[model samples]
Target chain A: MRIVVLAGGIGGARFLRGLRQAAPDADITVIGNTGDDIHLFGLKVCPDLDTVMYTLGGGINEEQGWGRADETFHLKEELAAYGVGPEWFGLGDRDFATHIVRTQMITAGFPLSAVTEALCDRWKPGVRLLPMTDDRVETHVAVELGGERKVVHFQEYWVRLRASVPAEAVVPVGAEQAKPAPGVLEALAEADVILFPPSNPVVSVGTILAVPGIREAIADAGVPVVGLSPIVGDAPVRGMADKVLAAVGVESTATAVAEHYGSGLLDGWLVDTVDTDSVTRVKAAGILCRAVPLMMTDLDATAQMAREALTLAEEVRQA
Target chain B: MRIVVLAGGIGGARFLRGLRQAAPDADITVIGNTGDDIHLFGLKVCPDLDTVMYTLGGGINEEQGWGRADETFHLKEELAAYGVGPEWFGLGDRDFATHIVRTQMITAGFPLSAVTEALCDRWKPGVRLLPMTDDRVETHVAVELGGERKVVHFQEYWVRLRASVPAEAVVPVGAEQAKPAPGVLEALAEADVILFPPSNPVVSVGTILAVPGIREAIADAGVPVVGLSPIVGDAPVRGMADKVLAAVGVESTATAVAEHYGSGLLDGWLVDTVDTDSVTRVKAAGILCRAVPLMMTDLDATAQMAREALTLAEEVRQA
Candidate 1:
């Protein structure tokens, strides 16, 4: 089976790890969102890409789910001593080299997709990882801080502020003109199954769909497009997904999240066992629905969720 | 008395530390050469300036006489993992952040001198350190490599190649048109006495003199300018100073080095105790000379050298 998974950061990385375990013989292609990318300390940092690469490459700090394991902060301390500190975000010494290489390649006129591909050469994360777009699409959040409305970069809102303030609006700048990376649309067209991992729907899958041809490609592919719910018991699995979802007027409910992705893109939807009652409502929204254990506790648990998602896709195709 | 010191790295940093102990009240100003500065991993690195700053700030690695104490190299390892191994020169994790901040500031339109000042704000070296120029002035070494004449950056020749290949020519690119940093001329004009630290006479002090008005300012200063010998018993205090001097067609001897600077700028000179017989020969070159124990073994020994240079300046003034 040729499975193509759309991913964000931590949630996406964890899900992919399980996806591999569930379908060991299948070739997996990952379409990672680069909307949260930020240029920091004079280097380009793609948080989602690094998370996926490090997690799959076996270099991730498993407990933190981001950055390289066994990292040091000597560079950050030195930057601080020079008073060049953006102190809120922790950029470890080992992690910084990733940003430096990506930034250098980008400055040398290579697109983000090409840079991501080159970086993956070192990690060789079993699955083929492709950035959703080559264009400069940055995720920004509108927040009122110090009694002033300002749009800060995604990292500032996510890492620095820890998403304390309500996101008035979340904008993926330059998404409108961003063309899908070369292999992205092709993967969607030829994919046996398209799985939307429990990543941020508004920022992850939504950003991938925002790229010009990607959404159309999946819609026209005539294959099962299934999405797993990130919300369980009216709360996000990880990160500040609810805060960002709320910025776009989406409620923190599995049913609402399914409705947000809507019938246009998703043919099947999988919600957590706790949200089984909402399956009827999700199916009523013209989407095939199934209730399953969606919390990825471990590799086995994650594989079970992946199996459930594939089973749900098969049922939707039959229906 | 006001004192001016021409310096390089390591030994220069250590000697400067002792000079501070010897003349705690003198307004010390350092005219650092920028020829050895190199851009690595997209960050500008001024090894000489950093040496002086870290040495005086009490953050220098005492054994290495360079880089930060308690430094980690997670960044370098990561960079190497990304296939960015500039394997020749060692760049510690702590040291990289300084370069990042410097590159950021320089790219933001601040001159090198102003950047040095801003960096010194945290270091508080208690002395002014100025680069020879704000403009780019790199030293290039022409050598026969792979049976073809090619020029490589100074760092590559010095650190990477270890100067094993004989340099056909040594050129200070852009030095003819480069201007001395602000306060350079003023420091020389107001100086009651000046002493050259035991740095590479050709690369360190020679590069400073290569700047348009710096050499003229020292000669025009109505004060005694004394220099300590870096060459003791026909060998450098440290590093490949002898090889670099040979490339520049200068002999590796205290008398020869003193004569290379000449009486045009220097009013007095200090040779190591082992080279006491060369004192008369240096004096014959039309500069006042003194035989002194110039080895900077410790703070006491270095302070003694500084005191000797200062006393020599006084004798030349009174004579």
Candidate 2:
């Protein structure tokens, strides 16, 4: 079976790790969200892509579930000493290497997609990883600061601001004009099943879909497109998903998130057992819904969730 | 007293340290050689100017004579792991900060001179340090390599090859079209003594003079123009000065180096005591000459040499 996953950063990476184990024989392709990419110290840093690559390639700091394992922040410390900083974003020494090679290749005229391929050559990530789009598609968040309206980069909004302020608007600035990266549409067309891992609905999977052709391709791919809820009960499983969900005027609940992606693009939705109450509302919205244990407490626990999503996909296909 | 010094990397930086000690009351202006500047990994690295700044700023790795003290190479090691290299040049994590800040500023449209000043604001190196030109002026050395004649960067010749091969020609690629940086001519025109530190004459002092108006300004300044010979006892006191000097058809000897600079530009020449015999030869060429203990074994010794150079300058002025 060929599986495609639309992924964000840490949460999505963890889910994909379990999916790989749950369906070992399945060929996996990940269309990573690049809207979180930022230029730091003149180097193009694709945090989401790196998280997926490092998580799969055995370089990730297992404790943190992102960044390199034995990473040092001497580079970051030095940059701050020079008074060059957004000091909030934690880019370690090993991580800086990825950006350096990536920036070097990009400057040498390699597209971001091509650069991602070159980087994967080193990581040997089991899944074929492709960025959502090669063209710049920065996610900018509009907020009111100091009693005045202001706009900030996605990273500044997320990492720097901790997404504290109610986001007035969240825009994928260049997504409307972006074409799907070379392999993205083909992966969708060839996929036996498509999964959205429990990542940020607004900034991660949603931002990837915002690219002009991606949403259309996934909607018409004719495969069982399923999604797992990032929300459980009244809050996010990890990260500040509620802060951004609220920006799009969506309630912070599993059923609301499934309805947010909507029945047109989603065939199956998985909510945590704790939010079993949300299953009815989701199913009533014209989508097949299941309640499962969604906390990725361990690989076994995550793999069980993956198995459940795949089972739901089969059920939706049978229907 | 107002003093102007022409300098390169290690030797010149050490000399300036001594000059600062010898004349603490003097307002020193340093016209630093930029011919050795190279863009590696897409960042502008002015190695010589950095040497002067770091050395004077008390951050230099005293044991190595350059780079940040107690530096880490995590960024470099990671870059190599990604197979991004020129692994020959050891730029530490602390040092990478300087390049990153400089590259960022230059990308943001600041000239090299202004950037240097801004960087100095943190270092507080006391003297005014200026590059020979804000424009690019890379030194290229012609050599026979791989059974073909090729011109490699001066750093590649010196740092990579250690100047083991014979040099065919030495050229400062952009010096002909380059104008002296701001305050360079003004520094020279002011009624003061000008001193050439014992840096590589061919690549350091020679490259600085290659900028059109500088050599002419120093020759016409009429205030005593004195130089301490980098060559002593028919050999360079430090570095592979002989290899490049041969390319310019000058021998590596105290007297020969003075003759190469010539009486037109040089008013006084100081050679090591071992090269006392060359003093008469330098004087025979119509320049005043002296023999002094030139070994910079410690700070006091180096300060004494700086005092000797100033004394010789005064002697020539009296003559």
Candidate 3:
């Protein structure tokens, strides 16, 4: 089977690891959200892409579910000492090598897709990883801080501010102009099943979908388009998904999230057993819905969740 | 007294430490050589300027005479793992921070002089450090590599090749078109005494002089221009100075080095006690010459050498 996954950072990366284990024989192509990419210390940092790459390649900090394992923050500390930073973003020494290489290649006129491919050449992440769009598409959040409204990059909103203030709006700044990276539309078109792992819908998977051609391609792909809820029991499984979901006026519930993606793009939706009650509401909205174990507690449990999603996809295809 | 010093990397940095100790209250301005600067991994690596800053800031590796004292090469190792490198040059984590800051600032349209000043805010290296030129003035060494005469970067020749082959020519690639950095000529004009540290005569001090207006500024400054010879006992005290000195057709000897500068530019010259017999030969060339214990074995010994240079400067002023 050829599976295409739209991934964010930690949660999506962790889920992809499970997906890899569950469908060992399947060819996986990951369309990583680059909206969270930030240039820190003049180097390009693709948080979501690096997470997926490192997680699958065994270089990830398993505990944090992002960044390189055994990493040192000496470079970050030194940068801070020089008063050059967004000291809030923790870019470790080992992790910095990735950005440096990516930035160097990008400056040398290689597109981000080509650079991603070159970087993956080292990780051999098993799956081909393509950035959603090579063009700059930063997710910015409009928030009221100190009684003033301001738009901040997704990273500053998420990593620095910790999403403390209410998000008034969440905008994928350059998505309207960005074309899907070279292989993205083809992968979706060729996919047997398209999965949205339990990543943030508003700024992660949502931003990738916001790219001009990507959402249209997936909707037209003729594959079983399925999604696993990031929300369970009216709360996020991980991360502050509810906060940004509120910005888009989506309720922090599995059924609400499924309805937000809507029946047009989603063929199947998976809610956790904890939110089993929401399955009927989601199915009533014209998309097939199933309640399964959605928490990625460990590799095996996560793999079982992946298997459940695949089974749900088969049910949607048959129906 | 206001003192101006022309400096290179390790040797120049070590000599500055002694000069600082010798004239504790003297106002020192260092015109640092930038020809050895190179871009590696898409970051500007200013070896000589950094050496001076780190050495004076108490961050230098005492044994190696360059880089940070407690440096780690994790970033470098990771870069190598990604197969991105000219692996020979060792840029530690701490050192990489400096280059990253510099590269970022430069890209943001700050000249190297402004970047250097901003960097010094953290190092507090006491002396005002200025690059010889703000314009890119790279030193290229022409050598026979694999039996083909080719020109390579100064860092490639010195660090990578270790100056293994004879240097056929040492050219400061952009010197003719390059103007002295802001305050370089002013520093020379205002100098009470100008001292040339025992840095490489060919690439270090010579390259600085190659900047269009700097040599003229120093000669016209009318202040005592005294130089401590890098060569002692018909050989360089440290580094492979002889290989490059030969490229310029100057013999690697204390007396010969003084003659190479000539009386028009050099007011006084200091050679080691071993080269005492050749003091008259240097004097015959119309520049005042002295023989002193020039070995910088320790701080106190190096300080004595700085004091001797200052004393010689006073004698030249009287003459």
Best by lDDT: 3
| lDDT for position A224 in model 3 | 96
Candidate 1 chain A has its poorest 10 consecutive residues by lDDT at: A76-85
lDDT of 2 by residue, B71-141 (tens): 88888987887788899998988888898889989999998999999889889898999999999999999
Q: What is the C-alpha lDDT profile of model 2 across A104-177, one tens digit per residue? A: 89989999999999888888889999999999999999999999999999999988999889899999999999
In candidate 2, which residue pairs clash? none
Worst 10 residues of 2 chain A by lDDT: A75-84
Candidate 1, position A197, lDDT: 95
Stretches of model 2 off by over 4 angstroms after superposition: none
Query: DockQ numbers for every candidate?
Result: 0.83, 0.69, 0.87
Candidate with best DockQ: 3
Tens digits of per-residue lDDT, candidate 3, A234-274, equal 99988899999999999999999999999999999999999
The DockQ of predicted model 3 stands at 0.87
Least accurate 10 contiguous residues by lDDT in model 3 chain B: B230-239
lDDT, candidates in the order shown: 0.89, 0.93, 0.94
TM-score of every candidate relative to the true structure: 0.97, 0.98, 0.99
